[model samples]
Structure formats: C-alpha cells, structure tokens
Target: MTEDMKMDTVVALLRDQPDPINVLYAVSLMGLTKGLWKVSGAGSAGVTRAFGEDIWRLIKIGSTLLKADQDTSNPQKAMEFYDSYLIGRFNVADSMDYDVTDDSIEITVKNCRAHHYTDYLEENDVPRSVGCPLALGCAAMMEEVTGDPFIVDSIESKDGNSKIVLKKF
Candidate 1:
C-alpha cells in the first residue's frame, strides 16, 4: 500500500480503539518491544538502547501531528501543546510543573513513568540504558514547533526526570 494509505489504516485502527487501549498499544508496546529486544540476542542491549531513542522520536513526532494547528512558537502556546496534547494524552507523569514567560518555557517533570521504571529495573537487577538522550525527540519536536532552541537536562536524582528549557535560538 502507499504511505498515505498505510498511515490512514493505522489512524483508523487507533481511532477505533478506546483511549486506554490506544495508550497501551502505542506507549506500552514501545517499552515492551524494547525490553524483549534487549533479551533476544547477544548484542541486543545496545540495539535496544538505540531503539529506545527512536521510539521516543516517534512519540514526539506524533505529538507534533496532534498539535499541528496550534501556534507552538509562542511559549505559552508551546506550553499548552505540551500540557494538553502530550501529558493529557499520555498521562505519564505524576506531576508536570511548568513556567512560561515572555522569553522561554521551563518544564519540570516529577514522578514520571521512566523514573518508576528505572527504580523497578534497579530492584530487579536489570541494567538501565534509557537516558536523557531518549528525550532528543521531544527537544527536537519543541524546537521545530516553537522555533526555539531546546535543552533537556537529565537530573541526577533518585527519580528519572528531566528539566526541559525552551528558548528562542
């Protein structure tokens, strides 16, 4: 099938599913597939780490598509897109505190699923590979939508969280 037709098919499938089912299919499946890949071959751990980054890239791209019409260049609008589209759709963070001023937007995530997953992995003696680089997709998406330069600092804390700052380049 053509690319447009393929995309339409996927969209139709997702649109027909319940919201929770869509979340589980799109979000949980990414993590589950990565986990499975990590155990499938002798060198699969490295491949899984790279795949994690690609998976996040897809998520960010999907978010941009969802907010295609919003004026994301405005810091406030970008914040709205992040909150309304990303967080609202994914429900991945326990708390997402944000500040949007005339010049920039600062987002701090607390009690995120990745943080909890890292904790779980640690408890089970599984190696942790996903890191701030996985957030490249998010920063890139915000930059594209907002016409800003973005940076994500992976805070070295017990919880796996990052502080993302977006400002005009």
Candidate 2:
C-alpha cells in the first residue's frame, strides 16, 4: 500500500475503538495508541500482550520505565525486577477500559516490550525483582511516579520474528 494509504488506514484504525481500549499490530513493538502505534524500541517488528492489572498506581510506574530504558536500574528504579520490566515499563498505556469478565478484568496494551518481561511468576512483595536490573529500576521509578498497583497480564516473545497482533477487551 502507498504511504498515504497506509497512514490513512492507521488513522482510521486508531479512531475506531475496539473496546474501552483496543490494540492490534504485526510486529515492531506497536502500542495501541488509539488503534495501533509502532514503538521505537523494536529492532524489526513488534507485538503486544493483554493485561489484568489490578493496581492502577503501579501502572504509572511501568510507563516511567519505557520512558527511560537504559537508566531504569537506578536505585530509584523500584526494588524489584518484575515490577520494573513487566508491571512498570511494559504495561505503559493510558485511557484504559476495564473489562470485567467472569474470570479476569481485561485491559488492552499494545506495542509492549515482550523481551523485557519477567513478572510471569513473581512473589507479591514490594521492591520489584525480576532479573534485569534496568527493568527493575525502571519499575521502581514507575511506582515513584505513577502510584498505581500494577500487575502483568502476559509476556509474549517474538519466538522467531513474526508480526504481532493484539486483542481488545
């Protein structure tokens, strides 16, 4: 497709709200900015993961990490890993719509850094500690900034370099 055509499509998709928040992508760490947006962190393509984050304050902490990648491991970068990389940074998104299903509350997050994820199985304790220091640090900063209780939904890896597509709630 032509550049204009592609942009037009993107604009249209962004404007079209799937749920309270909807996201879709074919790779390149695209975030659901309205519809789908490409994140610069990706080397080639991008992907996204859904969320059931119960703590709103922690959500802000994760966003702070994305804003600062290399500098996230500072002492202020939370005292944990999962909280930094997964909860604080990867789950960075505003204007969320909560989907209360029979099992979980679905919140859509697009263009999340899958590789940086580490909160898959962490203890419910403070002072984030996943593995990556930078990621953890970033999560710490996230808590300092956003004061929300953030949790991870899923950690998706590219596996072998394929396009990423996200589902809306």
Candidate 3:
C-alpha cells in the first residue's frame, strides 16, 4: 500500500480504540528511539540512556505546559498528581504505585505501553535497564514537582511491569 493509505488504515483501526492518542504516542516514541539508535550508531543502552537524559532536560517544558492548579510542593501530593497524570492525561499506563521518601520516589508502572519497545530492545540483547518513557516521565515529574534535579537511579521490568527509582540530588 501507498504510505498515505497505510497511515489511513492504521488511523482507522485506532479510531475505535479507547485511547488512540496513546497508541500513537507510544509508536512515535518507539520510532524515535529506533531511529536514534540507527542514525547515531550507538548501542541500545547508550541510545536509551541518552534518550532518558534528553527527556530529563526537556521535560520541564512539558511539566509547565501540563501543570495543574493545585500545589504539588509536597512529595506525596506530587506523586498523587503524577499518578493521575499518567493514567488520565498521559494515558501511557494501566496504573501506577509510588512510594515517596526524603529524597527518592519509587514508582511501579503496570502495563505500560512503552514496555513493548523495551521488550523489543531486550530481544535484541539490550539490557532491561534501558530506560522506558514511563521511567523518564516519572523522574521528570518528580524533578519538576520538587524543584530538585532527580535522576533515574534504577529501572527494571518484569511480567509487563516496570519499577523505577528516581533519586534527588
């Protein structure tokens, strides 16, 4: 099929879905990650790490644009907002559980759409630690809410769930 026809077909298929925008978003992120890996001639881990770093740098703009009216200064409140944002606005995950501490946020993402890309990378021998969008998004949200730079301390996936730890510095 022609490219336009192919896109039209995909769109038509997605139109009946509950959250078509999320599917598109997930596909775009996967394409971008794959493209960056190919064009940069970088290892999968390197590509994903760089992608995460870029997300960290750029996410402030997204956080600002998506900011809610409530005060999220408290870490617990911030996490609550992040959870709602992930399920409601981002539409990237089925659910999320978070634990907030003095300087860290541990987030478990259930049924994240980006797990497909992470699995693809792993099938090609990439490490599971390769960052996923959900991980980066959580770290970014924490940094934005706390007004402190938060780094992805660790990320692991198993059985369609991803656990991410963001540590403030």
Best by lDDT: 3
Name the candidate, 1 or 2, with the larger lDDT value: 1
Error in Å for residue 161 of model 1: 5.8
Sort by lDDT, top down from the best = 3, 1, 2
Best by TM-score: 3
On the 0 to 100 scale, the lDDT of residue 162 in model 3 is: 85
What lDDT tens digits, residue by residue, belong to model 1 across residues 98-152?
A: 7776545566777565444443333333433333332444455456565655544
Task: Report clashes for each candidate as comma-separated counts.
Answer: 0, 38, 0
Better of 1 and 2 by TM-score: 1
User: What C-alpha lDDT, on a 0 to 100 scale, does residue 43 get in candidate 3?
Assistant: 59
Tell me the deviation in Å of residue 80 in model 1. 1.4
Tens-digit lDDT track of model 3 for 37-113: 56664355555655655654444445668674444678898678656665776666899998997599888888775
Name the regions of candidate 1 deviating beyond 4 angstroms.
1-71, 101-104, 116-130, 133-137, 154-156, 160-169
lDDT of 2 at 27: 17
- Of 1 and 3, the candidate ahead on lDDT is 3
Candidate 3: where is the Cα deviation over 4 Å? 1-28, 38-69, 125-131
Computed on alpha carbons, the lDDT of every model, listed in order, comes to 0.51, 0.30, 0.65
